[model samples]
Target: MKIPIAIVGCGGMGGRHLLGLKELASSDMNNITLSAVCDLRRDNAEHLADDAEELLGSRPLVFDDMKRMAEAMPDLQAVDITTDARAHHLVASTALDLGLHVLCEKPLALTIRGCNRILTAQKRSGKYLSVAENYRRDPMSRLTKALLDAGSIGRPELFMDISASSGNQIIITPWRHKKNMGGMLLDGGVHNADMMLYYLGDIDQVYARIALWEKTRYRPEGDGAVSGFYQRWFGEMPESIEATAEDTLTAVVNFNNGTMGQWTQSYAAHGRGFGHKVIYGSAGSLRPGGTRNGAPPVLAHDGQDEITGSPLLDLVPDFHLDAITSNLFGADRLASYDIPFPAADRKLLAIELYELAACVLNGTSPEVDGFVGRRAEALCYAAFESSVLNRPVSLDEIESEQVGSYEAEINEELKL
Candidate 1:
């Protein structure tokens, strides 16, 4: 019996899920089906439906409205939501309430209150809800986890992560510019923050500073670029847009395990170097490569030898679009190759799919559940609070009705 899956928001991320599900279906590892898909645009939904039908040999129901799709396909066991951060709460809450397991894209919500609402919905429904914090599941990241567990770095004492962009050329959807939709920190830094939490433990306190870059340019009113053809089709002259949200943020976080950590994210840096994270301990250090569109290097510090060493960890092959097609249609059924996606973003997509599959088959909630999502979102809020007040904000200062229970669970998980 294949688990029937539905996807909402047929954007790039949504299309990626459809592709992954099609691959999984062809693998026949676990019985899974793409039962339905929904998007706000009829054309986008139809395009995905065409792809799904060609790949799966069974057409999935496509609807412009998610609610209509859910009603039409009552057997939908799980849904992958790739909508904007602002709509995450509404879409995820509806899916969970309807007894469908949900895998929502990152940030969880723009506001802490929105995150809490999703958590409340999850608790009430008792349905599985997982955020697509995929960086934690990347092959290299997995290796980092294994090394950390194996004590590659002895007692991770100090951690630093730096993420700088050469001015993001985002195709401006209005929601992206809106602070309520979760600006840069909530939109981009959520992944950075989540990865930090995964490597280090829970944060005890946060102190931060935020700044907006005044030089970036964008059209005042136009849809964002599709590919590299922004200037060709839109004909909208780029004008210096006032950055209402922070373009750069630097924060110091105190982890519960007494590790001092610092993270910096900037969208204004030039010269094209990717972001990097280095975890240091008394004995050795581990530094993972930047988030550029290339193979990431996971290097370990050998304190005994007093040098950094790169072990011959097998590099996962990069599967092209043809490989994706073959994996779906089975012209040449190669053994399931564990190819690594380029960066954390794609790996996060894979984890979301796996979590949805798990929820459908095993009836267990995802490891990164709604509550965990809220915790991450709350940390972002705390960072903002710390910046505004010019003081470190303790995790305890963020008031949630469920904070007591949340802290207890976190404490138990950390064995603190």
Candidate 2:
């Protein structure tokens, strides 16, 4: 049965989701119909509905309110929430309370308490809750996990996920710079947290120093400036805006499995920027590719040329993408793909949407379910807690709210 679904929050990510829906429809795994698009902004909702019509050959009903959309469409089985970070818990709790499955975007909620609120609602409603974590679904991520599991990267010793960007410009949206709104760390760092968990394992503790290096951010000067996939931002923007969120962090994380790594990210590095996700094992080292870039993993031995591209596939002969993911991207056993930007983004999101549909249809768990998402989010919080305490903080303490000085303000604002 095709599940009737609605997409909440018709903004940039929402538009990309429409593209994802189109890609899902093209694949054999498609199982959901875009019945509606909901957003507080009527113009945004209508605009995305128009794009949906052009892409999917039919326009979805537009709503300025989610409750109105739900009341209007009794058949709505689920919702894909692409709303901003702060609204995730509210929308997800409401959707679950309404007896509908939910696929919420990353950082599940702004704080652990907020995440617990949604989790509590899901428990009460007994509806499926899937976190829209697309990074782990990438082929490179899948193969990397396989190689590590298969001992290709024997006894993984150290994993490093380092990223440094130099810019005072607005990152996608203005709200992202606000601490109460999840900020750059929670909004962007959740991906890194998830990738770390996916590549290594559960994090035990984190010692971190967090800072806000760039307090003032500037918006793009002219129209046609791109932020993410396609032209996400256009027209005139504010000259400058004050940022409250911490933009820089350097942390040493200890994994539960005896592995350790550093997670350093900054938006205030002025001179130069670099990024990499490489794990060094006893036997060799493997560097995985980006989430949406479709680049292949690079494997290096002591005296061997780095193996990547098609040859990288040979390292993990038993590695393969699942049938659904394989068909969605038109690749199954291949190590790397060359799918371009919008398509790559769409395909990954489609995989998320399809997983939500599959769970609703088949009673299976999602690859990135609520608990997994909560853990990824909690790791970020752990870093913040560590920063505030000036000491290493355990994941248990962070998850249990025992150590929450950093999140106290956000939790107070949210009152969750």
Candidate 3:
């Protein structure tokens, strides 16, 4: 029997998760089904249903309200949440209390208070909750992790993650640029921070600084005067927009393992080659993609010549919907394409579904659990704190609170 899954939020990322689930459903590794979907917009929910039906030969129930949907569908085994960061805690807390396994999107939540709330809910309910910190699942990043674990990069002393994109020009959506919805650091760098924790272990403290370069711009919707990156990207030029949220953040983090590292996440930079992570160790250093200026990305004990070549780009998997091919028809072609396939999130989503189905049928814990998710969330907050205070902030300094009552209330709402 297929483990029934529900989804909340049917936007770009949510749609990608649905597509990935469709591919997983076709595979024999697991029997899974998208039984229900919810979005703030009814049309978006229906669109997801229609897409699932066309792609997977099954149509899921669509609803505008996730709470109402969960109430009506008690049989749902799990819920995949891809809403904005602000709603992550609310939706995930609700789902977990209802005894539904939750696979939530990253950052977990914008504030530590909210994260604690979700954590409390998980503890009280004992329901599975996992954050979709997908960058760790990226083939290149995973390979880097393998090298680090294998001691190929023996005892990493310094780690640098420089992630800059061409800006969110493609993302005309208003929520992404909003500070309350989690802005860039929370929205984008959370994955990088999670990946760091995955490789380097827990962070003890962090110190950081942040900046927003572009001040003003015309709104994409032609509205007047917005703030921060949204204003720069959408409002008028030369108008100084107050960046209540950090757009450029650089931080030094102290890990419990005694390893020290620096991370820089910036949206102000305009460049083509931006995303890269390099680890310097006692033995060898591995950098994703090859090095700049024709240098090798990975440097080893024996020097650069000893560096092994990267995994063939063609062999990388595509777990998301590409512009040209469907996952069903593109299976064989995945080997032919030279480009690195699927964004990191899609790959993680696929792996997550596989594990989720197994856990449901066999009754085991997920590979990544609520504790792991919380740890990742902590690192991100530490970075934010460090950046804000301009000094290292210890994890112990941060208070830990539970959301058991909050989740219980939500569960009652669901009649769970």
Q: Which candidate comes out best when scored by lDDT?
A: 2
Considering lDDT, where higher is better, how would the candidates rank from best to worst?
A: 2, 1, 3
Model 3 spans > 4 angstroms off? 165-172, 217-244, 271-273, 289-299, 310-340, 343-345, 399-416
Give a tens-digit lDDT track for model 3, residues 1-416: 77888889886677778767865765555457889889998887887788888987888998988778878987888888888777777888887888888888777765666777788898888877777765554444444555566666678788888877534232334454556566676777776767778888888877777666644322333433332213323532322334434567788888888888888887656667477677788876667532112122354565346454433222223323232123322432221223334433344467666666777777878756767776766666666665555667776555353213222332343333
TM-score of 2: 0.97
TM-score on alpha carbons, each prediction: 0.80, 0.97, 0.79
Error of 1 at 41 (Å): 2.4
Candidates in order have lDDT scores of 0.65, 0.87, 0.64
List ranges where model 1 is wrong by over 4 Å. 171-175, 219-242, 271-274, 289-348, 399-416
Clashes of each: 2, 0, 12
- Which ten contiguous residues of candidate 2 have the minimum total lDDT? 228-237
Report the candidate with higher lDDT, 2 versus 3: 2
For residue 400, what is the lDDT in candidate 1? 58
Top TM-score: which candidate number? 2
**27-80 per-residue lDDT for model 1 (tens digits):** 545456788888888787887888788877988888888777778887888888
Residue-wise lDDT of candidate 2 within 1-416, one digit each (tens)? Answer: 78999999988889888889999998777898999999998988998999999988899999998888889999999999998888888999999999889999998988998898999999999999999888899887887788788787788889888888858988767788999998898898999999999989998999999999889998865544555533544443467889999999999999988888989998777768888778999999989866677787888889878888887777678777987789987778867777787788889999999989988899999888899999999999999988988999888887787878888888888877
Model 3: how far residue 357 lies from native, Å = 2.1
Error in Å for residue 388 of model 3: 3.1
